[model samples]
Target chain A: MAYSNKARDFFSNELKNINTAGTFKEERYIESPQGANINVEFPVGAKPKEVLNFCANNYLGLSSHPEVIEAAHQGLNERGYGMSSVRFICGTQDIHKELETKLTKFLGTEDTILFPSCMDANAGVFDVVLDKEDAMISDRLVHASIVDGMRLCKAQLYNYKHSNMDHLEEKLKETQNLRLRMIITDGVFSMDGDIAKLDEICDLAEKYDAMVMVDDSHATGFMGKNGRGTHEHCGVIGRIDIITTTLGKALGGASGGCVSGRKEIVDLCRQRARPYLFSNTMPPVIVAAANKVIDLISKTTDRRDKLEKNTKYFRDKMTAAGFDIREGVHPIVPIMLYNAKLAQDMARDLYEEGIYVIGFSFPVVPKGQARIRVQVSAAHEKEHLDKAIAAFTKIGAKYQILGKKKDEIIAQYGY
Target chain B: MSDDLKKLIIDYVKKEYLDDDSEEIDESTQLISSGIVDSFSMVALKTFLEKKFQISIPDEKATTEAFDSVNNMINLLKEFNVA
Candidate 1:
C-alpha cells in the first residue's frame, strides 16, 4: 500500500522551503579525501576548483592517511565489506572485538560495546539503563543524541545549567530521593567550542553518589596531552562511569560509535540497547580503518600537537585581523557576526573567495548569536590559515564587521 | 503546585535559552508541535516534569502526545495521579 498523501505533502513543502532558504544546503560533492585542501566538483563541465576546507571534523588529518587506507583495504580483502547482521547475531568478528578492546584500553574503561553510529549509541542508551526507579541528570546544552536517548528512558530527568557545577549540585540534592542517578554531558561542546568542566562534574558526582557519562565525540582524538578526551584533559581519566564517542570525526571519517565503561554496564548495553540489537554491525572496512586511526593517534603526539599549533595560529591571526572570534582552545572557532543576514552574507562571500565555512544562526543557534563555524585541522598549512585570515579581513571590512585591528582596539582602549 | 511549575519552567526558559523578553507562554499552548521544544528539549522537559511534579515518567509515555502543550502535560500529570 502507498503511504498517506497528507504527510508527503507536508514533508515536500518543508523540503522545498529548506532549498529556498540558504539553510536547505545540498552537499557540494568532493572529489578528494577530507583534508586542508580539496576539490569540489560542481555540476556540468565546470572545473573542479581547490578550496581551503575549514568546516571538517578531521582534527588529526588522518582521514586519508596511507596507513589507514591500507588497513581498510586489507580488511576489505580479508573480511569482505560488511556483515549483513547485528553484533550479537554472528556479526562479531575478531577485528571488531580487537577494536573494542583497544578502545576500552585507550579510554581507561573496563569494557566497551560498538554501535553503527554515535547517534544510535546515544538514542539507544537511556532505554537500556534507565527505568522508572532511576534518575537521569543531564546538562541543558548536551548533544541532540543524548536528549533523544533520555526520552526513551523511564527515569526521572533533571538538567543542570551548562557546565555549572553549582547548579548540578543543587539538582543532585533535589533528586536525592530517586532510586539511582546518572549524570550525562558532552565532554566538549561542538557549537561554542568550549570544554566541559569535567573536574567539577566528577567532584559533584562523587559527593552526590551518582554515575557520570560523557559523549566525547568532539574531544576524543584532539583534546588532552595524549588525546584521551575530556577526562584525560581534566585529569579524571578513570573517574567517568561511561563514555560514548564516534569514529565518524577524528577517528577515521568513517562511521561507528561505542559506549565504553564498567564491564557490567557495557554488557547490559550490549544486550538491551535497541540500536545495537536491531541495527547491522559496522562494516569491516570501517572497523579496520578506525582501528588504524586510533593506533596512529595513540602512538605519537604528532597529530594532536600539530592540530593544537594550527588552532592557536588560526585563532590568533583571525583575532588580530579584527574579527570577533569565540575565545577558546577548542579547534572550533565561531566568528561572531551579530545579525543572521550578515553571517549568511559573509559565508557566501568567503565561499566565493575559495574558503569553505558554514554559517549557523537562529534555529541552529540563538538568533543574535549568528556566526560562521570554522573548524581548523592539523591538515591545514600556514598558507591555508593565512589565506583564510586574509579572506576574512577583506570580506569583514566590506561588511564593516572588522571592528578594529587587535593592536588598534587594544591601543584605543588604553591597554 | 500548578502555578509554581508554570513559573519555574517559564523562568528557566527565559533565563537559560531565550531572551528575557520572550513571548508570554500560556499553559494551553503547544510546545512541541509549535517547535518551541526540540528533540533535545523533550528530554530536558521530562526531567523538568519529574522534578516539578514528583512523578516518574516512563519512556513509553514520554512522547509528543504528552508534551505537545501545557494542557497535555497537565493531563499526563493527572493520569499519573502526580498532580
Candidate 2:
C-alpha cells in the first residue's frame, strides 16, 4: 500500500507547525519505576541520572510500594497474565467484581464498573445515557476526555465558565426545557490545583432538577479525610449523581478507572457503553493491585496523611520563599511563571539540578498561565522537600523569579 | 455599533485567547488556523457574541468560515443585522 500525497503533506505540515510553535511534546525515558526518585535518560544511550521526581501522579506513593508490587506478583502467579476477552464474554473474574464492589463502597456509590482507563470510562458515559433531548452542561476547563466524550454524544452541549456557579446556573436555566440535564466537571482541576465548588453545583443541580457528575481523577486516593475525593471533601458524597475516577494516579499508579454511580447507570453502561462493551477487561494484576490499594487505604490513613503533610509543607515553603504558588490544599501546586519560554527554562534548570519537574504552557493551560506543576507525594520526605526547595531558591534567584532578594528568601523560608 | 462590536470582540480575544496585550491583532488574522482560539474558546466566543449583540448564531454558522477572523465575525454579525 502506498501513502497518499495529501495525507503525507497534511501530517508533515502539521508536525512542522507544532515544532515551530514550541508545543512539540518530547518523551523522556525513565529508566526506573515511578517514585519520588527515579533515573531519567534524556537522550538515548546517555547515562541516566537519579533525580527527585516532582511531576508524577503518584500522590500516595503506591506506584512502587512494596505491598502493591507483592500483590501484583501474587496476582500474576495466581490469575495468570491477561484476560483475552471483554468482560461480557469471558473476562469477568472474581477479583474484578471484588474490586468493583470495593470501589462502590469507597466512593459511596450504588455500583461501579471498571474501564481500562478513565479516558475510556469518560468516552463511554455520555452517549449511553444522554440523547438529543438531553442537555449536558460542562465546565469549560473539564478534562480533555470529557470534551471528547461529549463530542460523541447527541446531547445539546453547553459549557459554563470554569468553576463559576453563576454561569452554570444561567446555563441550567437556559436548558430547563430539555428532557434531561446533567452538569459535569472535574473534582480537582489538574492544572491549577483548584477544587470545583461541588457543594454549590449540587445545590444548583437540585434547584434546576439536574444531575451532577464529577471526574475525581486528581483527588481519588488522597483528597478528603478518608480519601473518597472532592465530593467527600465538599460534603456532597451521596448528593453527586455520578463519579468517575482512576487507579492510574493515586491508587497504585497503574492503568484502570471506574464510573461509580447509580446502579441503573452502571447497568446501562455495561450493556451499551462502547468502551466497556468492546474493550478488554482490566488485567488481573492491575485489578488485584487496585483492590489491595483500596484495602490498604481503608485500613489506615497513614499514606494520605503523609501526602497532606508533604503538600502543606511544600506549598508553604514555596510560597514563603517568594514563589507564586497557586493557593490550594491539593497535592498539585502550580508555580506561576506567566512566560512560556521562562517556564521551559526554569524546568530545564530544575531538571539539571537533579529536581525533576515539567513546565506546562499554551494548549495544556491558557496562554500567559504557563507554570511548573509540582505534585507532592508521600514518598517525598523532609530531606526531599528541603532539597527541592533549596534547588528552587537557587534557580529562582538565578532567574529573578523570586519576588524578593535571595537573602530575603533565605531569611523568610529558612532555606 | 459595528465598530464597538469589533472592538469588543478584539478586546475579548486579546484578553482571553492571546493573554498578552503586547501582541498585535488585525482584522484578517487567522484565529482558528493559528491556534489563537481553540474549539472551546470558539464556543465561548459564539456565546459571548450572541449575548452581547443580541443575535442568534445558529449551530451551522458557528464554524471557522463564519468566525475565524475579525472580518468574518463582523460579516456574520452583519448577516444577522446586528453589526
Best by TM-score: 2
Clashes of 2: 0
Evaluated on CA atoms against the true complex, candidate 2 attains a DockQ of 0.23
TM-score of each: 0.86, 0.90
lDDT of 2 by residue, B1-83 (tens): 76887788888777555534598787888887766777764877897888887788899888876778999999988888987
DockQ score of each predicted structure, in the order shown: 0.28, 0.23
C-alpha root-mean-square deviation, candidate 1 = 5.2
Model 1 steric clash pairs: A157-B47
lDDT of 2 by residue, A81-107 (tens): 999999999999999999999999999
Report the poorest 10 consecutive residues by lDDT, candidate 1 chain A.
A406-415
True contacts kept of each: 0.38, 0.06
In model 1, the runs with Cα more than 4 Å from the true position are A1-8, A17-22, A42-46, A404-415, B1-83
Instruction: Say what the interface RMSD of candidate 1 is.
Output: 4.1
